[model samples]
Target: MLYIIQTTLTLGFVYSLVALALFISYRILDIADLTTDGCYVLGMAVSVTAAYYGHPIFGIFLAIIAGMAAGYCTAFLQTRMGVPSILAGIVTNTGLYTINLMVMGWSSNVALLKKETIFMLFKHLGIGGPWMDLAIVAVIVIGCMALLRYFLSTRLGLSIRATGDNKDMVAASSINPRFTITVGLVIANALTGLCGALVGQLQKSADINAGTGIVVIGLACLIIGETVMNGKKNMTRNILACLIGNIIYRFIYAIILQTRLIPIDFLKLVTALIVALAIASPSLKENFSLYARRRKESL
Candidate 1:
């Protein structure tokens, strides 16, 4: 049970970065960037390759750069090439398949089981323990949250938020919605790549298929957070909600896995069902209330 809890928290914290990325693109920029799946694999590919060369730290930076580049391509397609936003993301994502394969030396998977990773660095520095993994993930998550909070308070961040709220109004204010959108996506995808890099190192392996359905998972985390933490308008609250929601989601998964009530193959389906419920919760509640009221009136 303790091990399960720790695993859940570690995974939740690591994946919260993905939720944060989607929060920026989906919640803040109002763009459903499908580049997430590709960028995630891109990050893992880059990170594992770097780690294979004995530069695990440098691998993280390279992953972020690669993610930013992917974001730029997506943004350019939408902003400069007249491609629809969704279509631009799809194009970039599709192209990234080849790019990610190339980055992995034309392989579908790479193993880092024998490699030294960022987590191993902590172990080497006399911080080794069962809690070491959780501690490392917690530090990273907190740092990201703090940095994001500070960044979102800046003038440029306000422009991004404003662009999401009302593109026409931002244009009227001379904020250049195109620029804001581009910047927002770049930052969002950078975070996504970072998440992938961390997960690759943490798991000590990188697979081409690891990023499949990542966007859906991130969106589900975002919706779950919003539903649970509803009625909060503060940015900090909202950001914290993302992390908390991820933890809650992972915890639920852990519990379910332990129960073995369902087979492993259906886990993705379970996630989809959870997301569906979270997405429809508000409407479901409203309808239930209406039905109750109607029945009461008849009584």
Candidate 2:
């Protein structure tokens, strides 16, 4: 029981980073950037490759740089080349497959053999006991939430938010919507990359197919967070929702895995159902309210 709780908590924090990315791109910028799946593998490929080469810490920074570059590619296609936002993400994601393969030395998988990971280093810090891994992930996630909150409150962040709300309005005000959009996408992908980097280091391995359907998972997590707070627009509430939602999702998922109620093969399908239900919840509630009101009137 303790092991299950710790595992769930650790992964919950690790994956919340991807939820943060979707929050910015989907909720904030209102863009469906499909680059998420490939970009995640890209970060993992870079980080694990670097760790394989004996530079575990430097690998994380490199992964961020790589993620930023991937974001720039998508942004370039959208802003300069006149590609549609969704298509731009698809193109970038498609291109990342080859790039990721190259980064992994043309291999489909990579692992750290007798190598150190960021988690191992944190464990050695003498601050965390048996839960050192969970502690490290918790600190990183909390710090990210803090930085993201602070960033969203700044002038540039406001511009980015405004661009999401009304790009034309921002442009009319001479705020340069193009620049803001580019910056927003760049930052969002950076978070995704950081997530992949940390996940790779934690697991000490990277696989080409590991990131499949990751965007859906991230969106699911974000929507779960939004639903928890009743769709409130307060920045603090929304951010906390990100943390709370992931933990809740992980807890439920852990329970399912522990109980063997569903086969491992069907977990993804169940996850999709959960996401669909969460997405439709608002409409469902409104329908129920109307039905109850009609019954009351008849009575």
Indicate which candidate wins on TM-score: 1
Q: What TM-score should be assigned to candidate 1?
A: 0.94
lDDT of 2 by residue, 118-234 (tens): 878866667677798888888988998899999998999998888888866886777877798899889888889999999999899999998898988887878887788766579
lDDT values, one for every candidate? 0.90, 0.88
The residue pairs found clashing in candidate 1 are none
Alpha-carbon lDDT of model 2: 0.88
**Who wins the lDDT comparison?**
1
- Can you tell me which runs of candidate 2 are displaced by over 4 Å? 125-127, 281-299
Cα RMSD to native, each candidate? Answer: 2.0, 2.3
Q: What global local distance difference test value does model 1 have?
A: 0.90
TM-score for every candidate vs. truth?
0.94, 0.93
Candidate 1 lDDT, tens digit per residue, 1-299?
89988899999999999999989998899999999999999999999989988999999999999999999999999999999999999999999999999999999998986899988887877865888999988998899999999999999999899999886798688898779899999998998999999999988888999998888888888888877888248899889888988998898778778887788678888788877887788899999999999999999
Alpha carbon lDDT at 104, candidate 2:
98
Q: How many backbone clashes does candidate 1 have?
A: 0
